[model samples]
Target: MPKEWFKRVYVCTKPFMFMVFLQTSYAVKNLVVKSALNKGLNHYIFAVYRNAIAALFFGPLAFFLERKVRPKMTISIFLKIMLLGLLEYVFGILYCYFKNGSEKKTLNTERIT
Candidate 1:
C-alpha cells in the first residue's frame, strides 16, 4: 500500500512541475514585455494588446482547469470578483495615464519654439 501511494505521487509530480514551469515562464515574459513598454512605448495600444493576448492565452486554461471546482455560479461571488477587477483596472489606467501625461507635458514645455 505504501509503495502504491509513492508510485502515485511520483506519477503526479511531473505534471505539477510542468504547470509550475509554465506559470513561471509566463510571469517572466509578462514582466519583460511590461518593462519594454514602460521604457519607450508611450502608447496605450501596446499595453492593451499585450493584456488581450495574455487573457486569450490564460482564460481557456483557467476555465478548463477550474471546471470541476468552479463555485456554483453565484451573484455575490461574481460581484465581488467584478468589483476587484474593476478596481485593479482603474488603478492601472490611472497610473499609466498620469505618468504619460506628465511626461508629455514636461517635454512640450521644454521644446524650443
Candidate 2:
C-alpha cells in the first residue's frame, strides 16, 4: 500500500506547482524590467535583448519540432520573417498612443483633432 501511494504521488502531475512557477517568473520579469527602466535603460537596447533571448530559446525548439514537417527554408520565407518582425514593432507606437491618449482623454486635457 505504501509503495502504491508513493507511485501515485510521483506520477501525478502537480499543475499547481507549474502555475506557481509561471506566476513567480512573471513577477520577477516585471520587477527586473521596471527596475531597469527606472534606471534609464535604453528602450531600443532592451527590446533587442528581449527578442534575441526569445529567439535563442525558441529557434532551436522550432527547428527540432518542425524540422520533419515544415517546408524548406527559402529566401522568400526569410524575408517574410524579417517583415513580420518589423511589423511587430509598430505595436510600440500604438501602445504609446493608446496609453498617453487615454490618460489625456480621461483628464479632459486634450481633444483629438
Candidate 3:
C-alpha cells in the first residue's frame, strides 16, 4: 500500500469515525444518566463515577497496548503520567463541585419561597 493512498483513506474516514464516536458517546451518556436516576443516584455523581470507572478499566489496557509500540518508559515518563492523572482528577472534581453547587443554589432558591 502506498503512503499517499493511506493518507487519503485516513483523511476521508476521519470525519465519519469522529461522528460515530460522538454519537456513541452521546447515547452512552444518556443511558448512564437515565439508569442512575432510576437508581436514585445523583446525575453528576453518576456521570463522574462512571467516567472514573471507565478510566480505571481502560487506563491499564492503554498502557499495555502502547508499550508494544512505544519506547521504554523512563522516570520522566512516569512523572508525566502522574501529572496527567493529577490534572484529570482536579478537573473532574472541579466540574462536579461546580455542577452540584449550582444545583444546590437552584434548589435553595425554590425553597426560599
Give per-model TM-scores: 0.40, 0.54, 0.42
Arranged by TM-score, best first: 2, 3, 1
lDDT per residue, candidate 2, 1-113, as tens digits?
A: 99999878767757766888999999999999999999999989999999999999999999899889988889999999999898888776567658876635445565557
- For candidate 3, the TM-score is 0.42
Query: Residue by residue across 2-111, what tens digits does model 3's lDDT show?
Result: 99999999999999999999999999989977877998998788779889999999999998988789868899999999999999988876686578775345335332
lDDT of 1 by residue, 1-113 (tens): 99999999989898998999999999998898778877987558787877899899999999999999877968999999999999998887668657876534534543245
**Alpha-carbon RMSD of each model:** 8.7, 6.8, 8.6
lDDT accuracy of residue 82 in candidate 3:
100
Better of 1 and 2 by TM-score: 2
Model 2 clash pairs?
none
Clash count list over all predictions: 0, 0, 0
Off by over 4 Å in 3: 1-14, 43-48, 76-113
TM-score of 1: 0.40
